[model samples]
Structures are given as C-alpha cells and as structure tokens.
Target: MGKCKGLLERLKNNESIVVAEGYIFEFERQGRLKAGSFVPEIVVDHPELVRKQHEEYVNAGSDVVLAFTYYGHREKLRVIGRENELETLNRKALQMARDVADRTSTLMAGNICNTTVYMRDDPEAIKKTENIFKEQIQWAVEEGADFIVAETYSDLGEAMLALQCIKKYGKGLPSVVALVPHSKDHTLDGVSFPDACKQLEDAGADVVGLNCGRGPATITPLMKEIKKVCKVPLCCLPVPYRCTPEQPTMQTLKDPKTGKQAFPVDLPAHTCGRTEIREWAEEMKALGIQYIGLCCGNASHYLREVAEAYGRSPPASRFSTDMSQHFIFGNRKDNKPYYSETLRKEITTANYK
Candidate 1:
C-alpha cells in the first residue's frame, strides 16, 4: 500500500492526530519484557504481540502507528548484552509498524529515542548518540516510514542532535521531536520548556512538545508555556499516570501509603481514568496543540478517550461505555427488570442535587 498523508499536510488541513507510545512499560507490565534495560527486543522475540499492539492503537484512534523502536538503539541493546540484535530489532519493529499502518491506512512513524549515552559535555557521548539516531533513521527510511518521531530526550542538546540527524539521514521526512522534562520543568541543561521548544522550532523541527516524564496535570502547564512561543505544530504525549504539583513527574510520584517512588512499576493504581484523558485532550485541542497522545502506561482505552475528545469515532469507539445499559446506575427502561427496586434503593442512596 502507498504511504498515508504526511504529518505536515495533515496539520495544514487542520487535522489533529493522536500518536501512541509507551510500548516498553506496557510490554513490561504484561511480562513480555524487562524494565531496567527497556530494550525493545519484543519486536524480534514476539513480533505478533508488537503487531497486535500497533493494530490496537490504530483501532483506538491513533493516527500514527509509531514503530516500537523507542529503545531499540545500540546503547540500550548493549546494556542487555544484545547489541548484535540492534539492526534486526530496528528493522523488524519498523516493518511490523508499517504492515499495521498500511492495513489501517494510518501514518507510520519511525521512532528514535534518547540513547541514554548522551552527555551534556562529552563529545564522544554526543557522537554515539548521533550515530544511534542516524542508523535507526536510515532503517526507517528504507522501511518506508511516513515520518520520524524523535522522542523522550531530557537534554535539549540531544534533541537538537536528533533533529539534525533526522534531517541528514531521514531523506526529508518530517520530525516530531518531543522532550521529557523532570519535576524541575526544565531540561537537565537548564533550558526551560518554552525556550527548549522555541530552539527546536528555530532548528526546523516539524513538531515540538513534551512527552513521558509528566502526566496531564503536570505536563499541560509546561505545554501552555511552549504553545506561547512555538510557531510549529505542537505535540503533547504525557504519561497515563497522575502527576500533581508536588509530584510533577512520574519519577517523583510516591505511593501515598508507602512513601516510595511509584514509577516504572507499582503505578497501575495511579493511572489516569478515561475522563481525565478526555479532559486533557479537550484542553490540548483548545490550546491548538496539533499532535496528542500518551506515553508510558498508555493503553487502548486511554487513546480512545483522546480520540473521542478530538471528535473522532474510531473502530474501538463501537464499544465505548454506555452506562444506560448498566444494571445499577442505568436509566434505561430495559434495565429496570435487571434490578429490584430495593436493590436500586440500596445501591444508590444519593441523587443529583
């Protein structure tokens, strides 16, 4: 099948697309992969699983089926003693994503993430980082990726490098570069959110915004600042977990009872519900953010909420919640027989004021 509409054309036509990410965390939760290394070996190990995830995200209204290569870079694989599988993983993941995107008519994004080897002052670390992005991008180009998503960089310098690498190696593909600032609301290099976005835009990023580290509550504030400065279309894909002012990023979030950081694992209970995702999407659309999605902890249901809020009715929306068909809270006449009057009375003691 031919490629779908490119990101720039979609944005020009006033389209707001949802891009789903977070494969590592979700796969880890399903026991298909490990956490610390977070290499996307699942692409080479469980191709069907990765394919299903891409299909589900498309069904859930993700307009872009980003290749599950977020951490499939050389450095990340080297950590797991699988650096030899780097090329295999990147190519396989991109191909899997392409198949799903072609079937669904969704855009396929080549994903290059932070190499974790980049250092602010180390020239060798920067070169390694550039090399990692360059090789992955070359494979994406060969695999027919519609665009490139360079994401999860905490260092603005590294993000700039990724953008440069994409321009150099991506063969003119659009680049959606996203940053992940911690609780400080600035990059490790001390660049504020808005300033970082402005710099990316000036450097010719097709899209720039925040993703991953913060949730809706914490990320939105940073996005607001970015929106004020960036002329390019903005992208915002926050984590699905709840983040507050004090606990501004998932890494800082503590289990209320245990008082320990709840990130990476032990965060299922703190995930944002459908309502919160819907509200977050609504607010982002209102702010004119063009690309919206979820990062770590993302699921199909959450993407459904974001898509619905953006006025889309994807295939998965067929199963959206219909409380009227419920047993207790349902007001449908057909549901009356399912519950006794006494049961209803016992279940619902309060009514709307």
Candidate 2:
C-alpha cells in the first residue's frame, strides 16, 4: 500500500533484484481467449486470474510483483474499443498486484512499454507518443506505484522518450529501461546495444538492459557487451520462445538447427527447463546483473526455478520434495500403482561410483 521501501533499499544497496515477468496475454490464450489486443480486457474482467498469477510469482520468490499493465495504454485499448476504461484498467491491474503483494510483502512495479512510434522527425507522432506515455505514467503514480518499468522497445529513441516521461512524472520512483534488440548487439533501429545502454543511463534510467526478442543463449553475449559500457545496474528478461531471423514471434518461431517449428502455436515449447534457467541466473549473478527476470512465455514454475537457483526456497517446497516418491500414470486415482517395496528399498540403498 505504501512505497516499496524494501525493493528501493535493495537496489540502492547493490543487491540482486528478482523481478517476475508481467505477462497476461499468454494466460488469456490458455483459457481459449483472444490474445492480441484484448489482453487488458481480460485483466479488467478477470481480476482473480491476474491476482492468482501475481500470487504464483510471489510464492516463486519474486521480490517484485509487476502489474499486468504491459499493454494497457490508450492506443492498445482503443483497438478493442475499450479506451474509456484505460484508467480503470491500469488502476485495477496495479490493485491486483498490490493485493497479492500485501500477503508476501513483495514490491510492486507499474509497467509501460514502447509506443511503436519511433520516427524522430514526425512531430505529430512524437507529441502523440509523449501524451500516451504521460497519461500512463500519471495513472501509475496516481495508483501509488512503487516504481515504473519502461521495457521492450525496439528503438533507442522510443526508449529515451519513455525514460524522459518517467523522469518527468515518476515522482522520483526508480525506473528501469529495458530494450529489445533485433540481434544480440544492436536494436532494430541499428543503434548498438552499448550505445542504447549509455543513452538510457544518461536519460536517467536507474537500471538498463534487454528484454524480449531473444532467449538466454542469444542474450548472454549481448549482456556481456552491455557490461562493457553500462556502469549502472543491469536487467535481463528474455522471452522463452526460440527464434530465428525468419521467425521471431512465438507463433512464427522455428528451431535454427532443425528448421522446423519449435513449438505448438499456443504453448512455449522451447522454454528452458529449471536447470537451464538456474544456469542463466547464476551467470547473470556473476556478471553483476542486479535485476534478473523472465519475459514472455514465462510461468510460475520458471520463476520458482529462478528463486531456488538464487538460494531461496520456493513456497511449494514446504509441502513437497525435490524428488518424487510416487508416480501416477493418469487422472484415475484408484488405478494408480506404487513402486514395489523391494525396488524402493534397493533404490534407497543404491551406491554410486
């Protein structure tokens, strides 16, 4: 309900910050709903779903529960004829996160993203984009957001504008600016990653790094490059979908080696497992990345792995073990079989070289 003092203190003290991804569209798709432009509609209509997601991330060890307002801005809502509910949707999004955060004492972050109008010479577009960001940031501050995140920009200029808006109306709350590079080294607009990091840092971003567009394998090298020029805190939250030059979005993604679709249309089939995610977290920690999180296609299970990898026990561990003692074949409870006593005893006594 108040400012997120604990998170601010951690950032100021140079401690690692575990951020949970604020992805709502994918969950909507799980319920067989349209996902493109109506995601905010679902947030307004299904507050409980969003709250349950926030709670899952909190239990998975997120220090911050970001509001599900990634694309709830005016333009986005206008596409679905819901522009009138922009303020109400954004406020409700933050409220859902706040409600869950109160239970765990986790911090809350108000989220905004690129406006997709990055033409610097277009005065009309620039003014419109500024107004868009201004309105969103105002709502975020009005709703008592602890911090703000302007992420997933493909153009450095757009990211700069968002950062400027945040600096102007963020009410001194810390802000993170995360870009989505077309490749590992440069934004889609051709700005080098280092240049983007420097520009954002100069524009008053508290933390700067990359998000979306690529997975951990591609982002690792890019982060190493960012570390060279970025002195401020770094953040990384890559999408789980595997991508190729020809196919970037989850629906179009393909495996580079196999030359085939990497996953079903609705599921993140290429998501890294707990072990791989842990390795990514460990590497980022070594690289002095103070802010680490997941992006699109991330789930509570992935967040739990990140928390456990960072030495925090997942809340589920309180009722379960890392290893399972029983195996089920199907949903039928009565027909299930258990491991034989002799086999269980032998496994318990098995020796390794």
**Shift in Å, residue 228, candidate 1:** 0.8
Q: What TM-score does structure 1 among the candidates reach?
A: 0.96
Worst 10 residues of 2 by lDDT: 320-329
Candidate 2: stretches off by over 4 Å: 1-4, 242-252, 255-267, 319-321, 324-353
Which candidate number has the best TM-score? Answer: 1
Clashing pairs in 1: none
lDDT of 1 by residue, 166-236 (tens): 99999999999999979797899999989999999999999999989999998998899998888999999
Clashing pairs in 2: none
- CA lDDT, every model vs. true structure: 0.90, 0.77
Model 2 Cα displacement at 2 (Å)?
Answer: 10
Question: What global local distance difference test value does model 2 have?
Answer: 0.77
